[model samples]
Target: MSQSTHLPRTSLAALTLGAIGVVYGDIGTSPLYAFREALAQSAADGISRGEILGVLSLALWALILVVTLKYVLFLSRMDNNGEGGVLSLMALASRATGARWLLVLIFGATGAALFYGDAIITPALSVLSAVEGMRTIPGLEGMGEHTILITTTLVLVGLFALQPRGTASVAGLFGPVCLVWFAALAGLGLWHISRDPGVLAAFNPAWCLDFMESHGVTGLFVLGAVFLTVTGAEALIADMGHFGRQPIQLGWLVLVWPALTLNYLGQGALALHHLAVSEAHHQLMGNEDWFFLMAPDALRAPLVVLATLATIIASQAVITGAFSLSHQAIALGLLPRMTIRQTSAAQVGQIYMPAVNWGVLAGVIALVFGFRSSSSMAAAYGIAVTGTMVVTTCLSFIIAWKYWKWEPVWAALLIAPFLCLDLFFFGANILRVTEGGWVPLLVAAMVGTVIYTWLRGRRVSLERAREQGVAMADLAAALAVRPPVIVEGTAVFLTQDPEVAPSALLHNLKHNKALHRCSILLKVETVNTPWVDPAERVKLEVLDERFTRVRLRYGYMDKVDLPSDLARHPGPQGGGLLSAKGGTSFFVGRSAIRFARKPLLPRWMTVLYMFLHRNAADPTAYFAIPPNRVVELGSQIEL
Candidate 1:
């Protein structure tokens, strides 16, 4: 179902390699800290052989059911015109059910907002964990927490600063280098496993059940840590548009899955081997830094370097994902338009959002300084990831039943097992609220509230504005008989409603007492799909030869260049009325909004909406209009 599935074999292989570098970066780095955290979490249960084996089993099955099956196989197919993300999925599902499903809209928006919290935490936690590997080095035992903290803060700052420059030059290396990282994971696990093959029995589900039975209620707490192994699953789905479907699936099944599985198994084996040989197994029970501890002293420093690089790569993936999500939000009208800068001429997906970049930077820095270490920050990570997965499951069920046209019973039956697994992960993470998990939840709640309020307030504002507008036909007929002083040059008025006269046009007529020979009203429309055909993009209607109305339709992913698109059609009635050589001015109306005496939106929302509106990007920049040839008309609206 990937758009590029029909590509030549060689090209497909190349994309598969590229997909490994970007898509797998987050989940791939998990072996560095995920296994250690899971081991440490088992301390609540009192360490035993059964508990170790059970934890490993739970991690393996999570990868199988959640990532491999749910995301790679099921959700990947739910693309919106070869694009995939929470917003795209929401658009697809909502189209099938129409305006009746309010639940779908709320869940879709919440899932998107939750992603912002994860974006902030990922860079801080990942860099801190990798830099903490300095603790495992010889003679650096006294280097302490302050040293790691400073080092991580510096790296994160530099990474964010470089975002404006784009990633195309060095992006090619991400693939070849990650290949080595996975190979190292696989090789390390194989070495330790050769020492004691008995730990390999964790591949069996029976071991997971045995460990659960041994630990009882405490074992459920381990699910929170075990959940980290698959956090990258959501990132992979969001990045599906960059590399397409088949490439991601091939990379995961072939390289990523086996490497991660082997590394986790290797850590388990090393822990068991240490527990059996040392008499002080109690001190070493849950303190299995066995991931780095498995290697020789000579290789430890090099592994740290490799890990630091990988985590940086992982951090990059999430930051880029944040940019993409923010762009989608602007297109869907969940937020006011922000400045979107295209960083690459060759690749359209390489974009940079200034607000998103700095906002995430602020959050990450606060998290690093506040949490102090990766172990502490790790408590905040899994809840957001699990919460998103649960939301995805519910949304996907709607897609299956409504869009894909499956029987309701069959769809629910198929998705029920995955939903149950997601709920268990969410519940396990609920226990972490006291242990610093409240950070992401609080951030998500604040963000989600703002987005919902902005959307609702905008809707009510539009309804009130529309009621004051006069129909274009009536205005056109009135002007034909009364005819204002006709001038020589051309004038263009931009409006939201094509059926009604633009406020800018009305204001110009009232003040100037003159009209251009060619007066055109142009309205921009955003389509529900990803890309609109250029042939069907611009529609021109005739209202007498001198006055015309043109409609430009664009998909959410499409960019509008009013100057360029109009260049193709010269004269009146789809012909170029506006000249490339002469005096032509674009008239835009700027609204000065005032809250109504009895507001439709909540009082708090009205304040936030006004603030966002004042700070949003200027229309002159967003529509790519030539600033030199623009005129502004001001109007006051009460909503």
Candidate 2:
């Protein structure tokens, strides 16, 4: 398949700002509150200015190391078509790794489920944090906290309401607004840095090293503390295909990274100045107001409004990502296909899976009511982010060594440091499972189990059906003696078991058994690649003189395009197989499987089969047939 260079060639400037807004929204907004939460967690005892600045510096490097260097710089290059998500990445691995793709499927589905949890938590916290500004509003002295919460909830509902209209309708403004958002963050930070230049010293690696050494395990605990700063980078890389790799990379390199660094430095400057000016101001809260302080008092209200808008944009990006991942999960066989309705024709990137949207809505509403504050929601956020990072790092090691064919020693050297850092985050986040982190972890486990079980049962069920199927030669010979009607065109039968008899064939013979003059068995095979040439398509098989079967091979990335211009292809030898004058009727048979145990995996999994029977995508949609003509042949199966 040819790689799609069809993305809009927006200026690097526009894409960067949008990338900052869309891809990095979660982490971009995190700097607003992460430092404060870190302080609350562990600011006592002996943590010094040098150690604090060092922690900030470590966060900067982690973003650079894990996100920019590992993923955007390299992994984004491994796109399956223009698709760049965990499931797409897993599909790419399947081509190179063979059966081992199952592990990748499991890992990717788990990551995707984790992302759903992240999506839910993000909107709850981002909106709540922005709305908390009501507490600081001048002359709003008597406003209740619940009043603010209620307003925030209403704002969030409004955001979700806009989803059905599709984001692309307003995405043009996303770039410009996001550009303004990052510029504001950077300009504010830089303006403060100019007032006190010594904060620049924290950029040096040694300060971070010194802090890590001095603080020991306490400093080590801060790894999770600082990890939040880089959480959205993976999402940035995952969504790169939507915005294009070059544009996204340019945005990060020119706009996001520098802007974020400046903001951190500005915050550090506030801390340093307070330490020197007042003894009581030497603690964590000393610079707590730096973000708010950046704006003039009169403009603070407007700045809060802008921050709220940016948070909404960020939440939209995550929600869309959840929709994309859910669709891919179905395509890859990890999950059964549901009703996948495309939300926008102009942008294939914009999709709406009702199942996921409602699921996320429920989770988000639950978190908002339960946690009630951004600080608590932060506890649940990292488990999904860190868990996904670990999964990606593990997959990268294999992808790098086997597919990229990096030198073993060189690949190990390249992958190990990041792996160790990810392990550290994973270890820290594991502690959080008892905390709010359990929300996503439990969700991921439940979703993953359902997906894996259904897929396994599907394979088992197909294998058993194949074993019981009668061969086409025998079936055709048995029916050859029947008189043929002088009917018009060929009837194409679509099925997976090629020569193996479809139960529908028997049912049709019994009921609608009026034999057509000619019939063709048409089987579609989804190949591993994206497209197949016509020369390899529609292979004709003559099963004796009477019966003919045609097979069409397609790549997974390719749509099952039934040829509308069939007039172009050469017809059968004497009279064409398709009679243009006489209309052709398409008949399809669907298997109706019962989950009654036939001694498959285990008894519990047999119960899972009951669920699968209820959940499987209707054969009508799966075959890509026009529903009006397709017939559902109900069959009772034991497995």
Return the top candidate by TM-score: 1
In order of appearance, the predictions have TM-scores of 0.96, 0.89
TM-score of 2: 0.89
Candidate 1: worst-modelled 10 consecutive residues by lDDT: 277-286
Task: Please list the C-alpha lDDT of all candidates, in the order they appear.
Answer: 0.85, 0.70
Residue-pair clash count for candidate 1 = 5
Superposition error at 10 for model 2 (Å): 5.9
The most accurate candidate by lDDT is 1
lDDT for 234 (candidate 1): 88
Writing each residue's lDDT as its tens digit, candidate 2 over 19-137 gives 76677777677667666555445566543567557876776777778778877787777666655666666666666687466687767777777777677887887788877765555
Q: Return the lDDT, model 1, position 474.
A: 92
